[model samples]
Structure formats: C-alpha cells, structure tokens
Target: QLRETLGIELPTNDAPPTSLETATPTQPVVPQSDHQCQSNQDQSPEPLDTSERQNSDLRAQSTEPLHTSEPQNSDLRAQSSEIIPVSSKEFMSVSSLIRGRVKLEDVNKTYQMIWTRFKEEGKTDPLTPGDMYKMGLKVTGQTGEAKLKVLRALKIVHISNKGAVKLL
Candidate 1:
C-alpha cells in the first residue's frame, strides 16, 4: 500500500527489479501531477554537486582565458603581440639563432682554411674551447664566444676536458 502511494517498489539487494519498474528501463520515472507539463520531453538534467566542483577545479587549473565561439578581437588581424606562439614556424633552432648573426657554412669554411694552415705546422691535437673562443672572437668579433656554438653546430670544432677546443 505504501509502495503504491510512492509510485515505486523499493527492491531488496538480492531481488530483481519488478515488471512495473522494468517496463520503461530506458526512461526516467517522473511523478505525474494534477497540473499539465509544459513539454513532453525532459530538458536540463538533474544538477550534480560534483559537476560544479569540476567546473571550479577546471577554472582554478587554467592560467589562460577560456575560448569563446565569437571572434573576440575587433580588428580581425593576426595577433602579433604574443611571441613564441603555439606554432612551430615561430620558433628558432640554436643553429638558426647562430645563423642570424653569422653564417655557419662560411664560418666553418674559414675555420677549415685556417685549420689546414695550422695542421701543416704540425698542430694535430684538437683545439680547446679557449682556442675556439679566440677563433670565434677573431672571426665573428663576438666577445661572448658564441661563434664557438656555430662551430660546434657545424661539427668542425670541439671542446676538450681542459676547456680547450679541437678540430674534428
């Protein structure tokens, strides 16, 4: 009698669902009221506390703003403001960075010409980092010894354990 009043029979853990409950397994059981429903279909699912917590957690985790459907920018121009964007073409390799100041091929050729002359003088050992640093300064006129990086990239010179460079 009590189950009839509530429109559902609570099943025991061991018992299978009754035919009355199993008739519409796919559908939600909504209690019929004396008033008419605005629509036949159910919209907006039952709100969950976990969903709200998840949304809050997502907002806390993100450092950047969320994306929207509409074009937010007014000018419709490419945004050049942010450097090192998500695009691959915008990034530069170390070799490429070296090339921006001095061409590696030219530097490598020049060093090889110099090295051949030195080799003829019986200097067979690899040049030290200091030697490369000196060479970098002499050839590229860069005080930071960054030209060695170009040489390293070109595989024409290498540094020794004692901090000197040797020609490979």
Candidate 2:
C-alpha cells in the first residue's frame, strides 16, 4: 500500500542484492608527494569557449569608464533638507509620545529633537519607512495610520502608501 501511494516498487526479501548494495567502502585517494600534485596541476583543463567570450565582454566593459555626474546645488540642498537625523531611541520615544495624542507643537518639537540627533550622528541620507520600522516605529495598524496622517497634515513627514516615509 505504501509503495503504491509513493509510486515506488520496493525489493522483496527474496531478491538478490545489487552491485551497489554489495559494494564495500574504500579509503579516499591522496597524493603522497608534491611531484604528484604538480603533475595534477599541470593537467588543468583548457577554458571553455563560453568563458572566453565572457572574458572578452568583461574586458570590453572594464575599458569603458562609468559616467557619473555631480548632483546639482539645488538637488543637494533639497536632499540635505529632506534627511531628518533622529536616533533610534528618540524615534521610539517620539512615536510612543504621539501614539494616542498627536499635537502639531509636540510633533514639531520631536522633529527638532530628531534633527539634532541626526546632525550629531552626521548621517546625510534620508530615513526610509523600513529604517524607521527597524528603529521600532510602528507604521502599520489603525493607530499607526492615524499618526502618519497627522504628521503628514502638519508637514512634518510624508508616508507613502507603499510604506516609504519622507521627512519634510
């Protein structure tokens, strides 16, 4: 019944053992001297035709310099302004403080605190919603959604439907 269900036929007790089943374990082969190892190394297989083509492609790519333009002054300024530097501790505290009662004045103060912390840390990148969540900020659920809406209304932060947070 089990063999039928599994779609496999098991050998009966009366069946003779196969060569594989009768085989004995053997010791692994190891080179006894460096001469044998050197001979083995000398017999290295030639590179495949596909590998040669890939190598040529890589060489061509390496010869071409990557183009990267400098960020515009306005773009730099906008990016710098958008990045709010709040520590994980401050973020958690502020999130908890504004949980049930979200006041604009309190939110503004919290933003200032975060900005100060960010400056102290010297991080210039904008904090994403994933980063905030990692720092213990719950940006899901009913309360989390409400808090995000309040923060957005006050122009403190913008939370995208796709879970991205941009601090303004």
Candidate 3:
C-alpha cells in the first residue's frame, strides 16, 4: 500500500506514447534567438490525438474545485470527494499541480519552460534526461519523479535510450 501511494518511480514496463517528433517530421532543434522563439510562438502547435483528447476530457470532467496550489498528502488538508485507490490517486495528485484537469496542457507549458530555460543558459543541445527531469520537478511542482512520468505518459516529452531529453 505504501508503495502504491509513493509511486515515486515510474515503471519502465509501462511505456510512454509515441511522441510528436516520431508522429510527425523531426521538430527542428530550437534555435538560440529571441526572434526564433517569437516566430515559433506566433505559430500554433499541432492538434491533439485521440489519447490527448481522452486525457483532456477526463480533466474537464473533474468536479473538484481548483486549488491555487495543489494539495499535499499530509495532515491539515481537506480531502476531496473522489476517493480513488492510493496509487492512482497519488499520480493524479501530481497533475493537480496544474490549474485544471487538463494536465497535458500543463506538460506543454512545462516543456516551454524547459526550452526557454535551456536557451537562457545559452545551450542549444537537448538536456540530459536527468537534467530535464530535475527541471520537470520545478516546473510541475510534483515531488519524486512523478512529473517526469506524467510528461512521458502525455507524449509531451521523450527520454531516449541514450538519456537525451527531447520536447515533443
């Protein structure tokens, strides 16, 4: 039961979805220029797939009130009406760091944050999976490696066999 609540490690057996990079042509490496960012920002991102649609749909269905900050699993916090299993509940709580049920969107925002941070650091190279996962912790505010796993599950980011982290 404790292992379930503390789903700190994402099992590698449950593979992530096919990233947009593989789904479409390889995304050009993000250039290190403000102009490049501005131009790209002007263009909208691609449409969501069936899995993404289902994920967003589930988010919208949550009747729970939005928390200014996500609720921590400790004493002093009020519990919600939905009582899921401990393991499932803990993982979903990671998504709760986001404003609404739409966690995939939050993953996108987190990707942009990572991209911008890398550019600001004057690096054009993709971050290593460890570095990117560390960045995920700050951007998503999900403890342990839950944020990394969530991002993987949503197909917003991918960590390769060589440990390179790519935004998708």
lDDT of 1 at 17: 87
Candidate 1 vs candidate 3: the TM-score winner is: 1
TM-score of each: 0.31, 0.31, 0.27
Model 1, residue 134: what's the lDDT?
A: 57
- Model 3 stretches astray by more than 4 angstroms: 1-112, 118-124, 129-142
Report the lDDT of model 2 for residue 65. 68
Query: What's the residue-level lDDT of 123 in candidate 1?
Result: 79
Tens-digit lDDT track for model 2 on 1-168?
Answer: 999899999987988986566656774445457675576657878776988989989999978965659643334434674544333333344444455654444444545544544555656566666665675665566655555655554445656667565555
**C-alpha lDDT of all candidate models, in order:** 0.51, 0.56, 0.52
lDDT of 1 by residue, 1-168 (tens): 878999997876878986567768687666577346656465556565998989978888675765669652222212322211111221123446564565444454555544653454557766654454455435434523455555555444565456455555
Inter-residue clash pairs, candidate 1: 126-166, 127-165, 127-166, 128-164, 128-165, 129-164, 129-165
**Candidate 1 at 79: error in angstroms?**
50
Better structure of 1 and 2 per lDDT: 2
lDDT of 1 at 46: 59
Q: Which lDDT tens digits does candidate 3 get at residues 1-168?
A: 656899776555556765543455556544557675576658888999999999989888785665757544332111432221223444465545432344444444554565466544546576665675676534333432344556555444566667465644
Model 2 RMSD in Å is 15.7
